[model samples]
Target: MKKIFYVFSVFVLFSLVSCVTADNNSKKSADNSSKNAAIENILNRKSVRQYSDKKVEQEKIDTILKCAMAAPSGMNKQPWEILVVTDKEKLEKIAEIAPNASYSKNSQLAIIVCGDKNISERFWEQDCCAVTENILLAVEALELGAVWCMAYPSDERVAGIRSLFNLPENVIPLNIIPIGYPLTQEQPKQKYNADKVHVNNW
Candidate 1:
């Protein structure tokens, strides 16, 4: 009886150590993968103004939108309305509406980030901005390029887009993003400034 009890104890200890080692390895692998993906997505992100003639796949576009929706909102209100535009004529008109976004004319797709004031009241703009950043990051992750074109706060641009889309009065256009395959490569430059950092207060 004593010999049998000793053997059982040894078996239990060995099994516990094995399970712990396996769990630690699995966690370490997951952590490394997450860290690498985040670094790659962030470091390679850059604005590409010029694009090739190639069309963006629908799957990638859907993934980008999914990522946009994954962003957190204030109080989880999620007061965002996304408008996807792919019509060639409309793309040309968008370029006309925002002169700085002339490169949009060549993009395969354009995403217009909008905020519905009726939903979150005051945090609509802030929530929309978070979604926009997620879209940009997803674009880079999918090996695509995009440029953000401001549309809000500009009466002319906002009115033009609203009129073109027949948007409701409560919906405000925030920005337009033109996405496509890059015509040229852009390297990410480090713009970090240590002086801008404040420990507790600015």
Candidate 2:
């Protein structure tokens, strides 16, 4: 019965190979699904100024802040301080002080991203920008709306925020982001520029 034994061995080997192939294919599909979800989240991000009155959950706010901290910092300086404002009076005052960010008056939450010169003297602005971007992306992932208002580089906005918050000498406000549920639906735009891309060499 040598032939019978040989046939059984071949059959078992073929079955094992098929099972392995199936498992690998399943894992690959899962990986692709995760990648696609992340890409979609990036593409679907849109600036939303108007917001619903519904308050944002504290858990989502914490998650977004965690993502902000996860941003890349030059030389690992990691120099960003965050401020969360939900008080109506403070938001109104901010809106008055920063005219361009009038949306803050109606927002349920406002986040102020700050740079600490004492921590990373040279790269604070760039690092704080990364932190702001992470905050926006995380907000989008949580199905919340947010719009960023420039704070730094503008003497009026910067000084206004500094005086309002009583920030120390080394602290600088970078941007103000108002986050909440969307009042008006907006779609993401395709901003890819072929002329702006250089491969290997400019």
Candidate 3:
């Protein structure tokens, strides 16, 4: 009787341990799957400038912003704001200020991604940059095209965007992204460079 009870107790402990291990493995698998999906999206992203005349739906715009917001931020402050421009008049004015932004005229939508200066200036730029890249990748995942035009790094450009949108003093424009259905496909450039890699020490 003692031998049987001891064996039964050991079996129960083994089963509990096995259950915990299985749960952990399941969680790890899910995490890996999610990571793979994001990698696939990134690999397929391409920068697109020319766009068709069709307008993007509000739902799609919201989806793109949702993805952008998912980007990692400094201390999770998330000090970013987006100005979605669909009005032709406003877009035209923006294009005027951004002379090199002729693509804005053809784009069905334009998003002015801004970062709050109150947030650490050091991370603000990098945080906004991550958001912009996420936005581009999201657009590509949704079968749309977008071009990222720098606006904040330049004082004149930032001032123009702020005035155009009547933004608050705290808000600093970082990038101008024109989004729409692409008229032409952009080929991805080969960016691999083995010489740039230095393992352990440079």
Which runs in model 3 stand beyond 4 Å of their true positions? 1-37
TM-score per prediction, in order, is 0.87, 0.91, 0.80
Write the residue-wise lDDT of candidate 2 on 110-190 in tens digits: 999999999999999999999999999999999999998998889989999999999987999998998899999889989
Q: Please list all clashing residue pairs in model 1, or write none if there are none.
A: none
Query: Candidate 3 lDDT, tens digit per residue, 114-199?
Result: 99978766688888899999899989888999889888778888889889889988899888898999998787666779999999
Candidates' C-alpha lDDT: 0.93, 0.94, 0.88
Question: What tens-digit string does per-residue lDDT give for candidate 1 at 1-202?
Answer: 9999999999999999999999999999999999999988887788988889999989998899999999999999999999999899999999999887788899888999999999988999899999999999999998899988899989998998999999998999999999999999988778779999999898
Error of 2 at 15 (Å): 3.6
| Candidate 1, superposed: residue stretches over 4 Å from native | 1-23
Least accurate 10 contiguous residues by lDDT in model 1: 183-192
Best by TM-score: 2
What local lDDT score does residue 68 receive in model 1, on the 0 to 100 scale? 100
lDDT-best of 2 and 3: 2
Report clashes for each candidate as comma-separated counts.
0, 0, 0
Q: What is the lDDT of candidate 3?
A: 0.88
